[model samples]
Target: MVRVVVVDDEPMVCGFLRTILGSAADVEVVGEAYDGAAGVEAVRRSGPDVVLMDLRMPGMDGLTAIEHINRLPDPPHIVVLTTFDADQYVLRALRAGATGFLVKSTPPEELIGLVRTAARGHTVLSPSAARRLVAASTDSLSARDRAREVVASLTEREIQVLAGLGEGLSNARIAARLHLSEATVKGYVSRTLDKLGCVNRTQAGLIAHDAGIVEP
Candidate 1:
């Protein structure tokens, strides 16, 4: 079963989500919280597979809470399921490590499927929302030029690794494709991240895509 913890400041929203997802045979409402702090506590206690988080909650807020939760030894997948998807908050939430973004207006069945996808470590984004995010990013010529310079620092083999990462391939898959050891692929990925001035693989992929190094 995919255990879930629903968090929102409003009781009605929390109850509504619980009711909607609770009906699924593959889903279980392990706990609920009215604010971010309580949501953190509930997540710890319930050991849920996914967290349905409201981005604008009081007392720590969803973005802050997600950062904390991500620091846990075994953090649950986080889905930013909020009424608001403004540029500022949505971008911040994604940067803080939300597994996906789902507006509260999403259909219940679709929401349930997204929750399941997140539980399995998938990166989910509504198609329109994703386009919006990409368009929202400035990606100025300077930034793209800088990104190209950064990418150019990598060896040809490492460039291949970045392309694989942009396609969401794991270390093992990259290794197989390149006829190299998994450890070698991991090293290439790490070096690419360092060269790209990125904090993680996800950021590197984003930069590569935006710079047209990896193309969409």
Candidate 2:
């Protein structure tokens, strides 16, 4: 089972998440916290496989908590809860080692699926969040230039893999798309992350989007 913790400032939101996640046979809502500080504490104590975190909270916002949790010996995968208006926070959280972000209005089924995906060590981004990332990239010329320079180091096949990642495709899917084995795709992804100076697939995806190597 995928163990999970729900962290949000609002009690209603926390309860709601717990209910939906609990409904899944393969998912267990292990804990719940009403603020970021408590969220961090809960994560450490419960050792959940995934955390559903709200971006804004009364004390120690989600971004700060994400940084702290990521430094732990065995950190849980964090999935930030956000709204479209909080796109900036979403990006910051991702940079701080969050596995992904989900809009607050996300359908219950998709939200549960994303938690499962994160537990599997895959990055998740809502479609709207992905669009915001593309928009953010469009406005930063320096970032674009740097991304392009980094991407230039990749081979043709690696470039294809990176593009697939930008589109939120998994290694298995990328392999099918490029007619390569899953192992080859995984290697290409790791190499691409190293070349782009990215800590995870999410960052590499952002770079690929910024470099215009993949359609937004």
Best by lDDT: 2
Model 2 per-residue lDDT tens digits across residues 1-216: 999999999899998998998899999999999888999999999999999999789888888998888889878888888877347777767766787888889999788888899999888874456657667743568768878988889999889898888888989899999888999889999888888777677777777777888765
Instruction: State each model's C-alpha RMSD to the native.
Output: 4.2, 2.4
Q: Give the per-residue lDDT of model 1 (tens digit) for 110-186.
A: 87888888888766664345435645766446656766777877888978888776666678988999999999888
User: All candidates' lDDT scores?
Assistant: 0.77, 0.84
Which one is best on TM-score? 2
Off by over 4 Å in 2: 126-128, 137-139
> In candidate 1, residue 137 scores what lDDT?
65
For each candidate, give its TM-score against the true structure. Answer: 0.74, 0.87
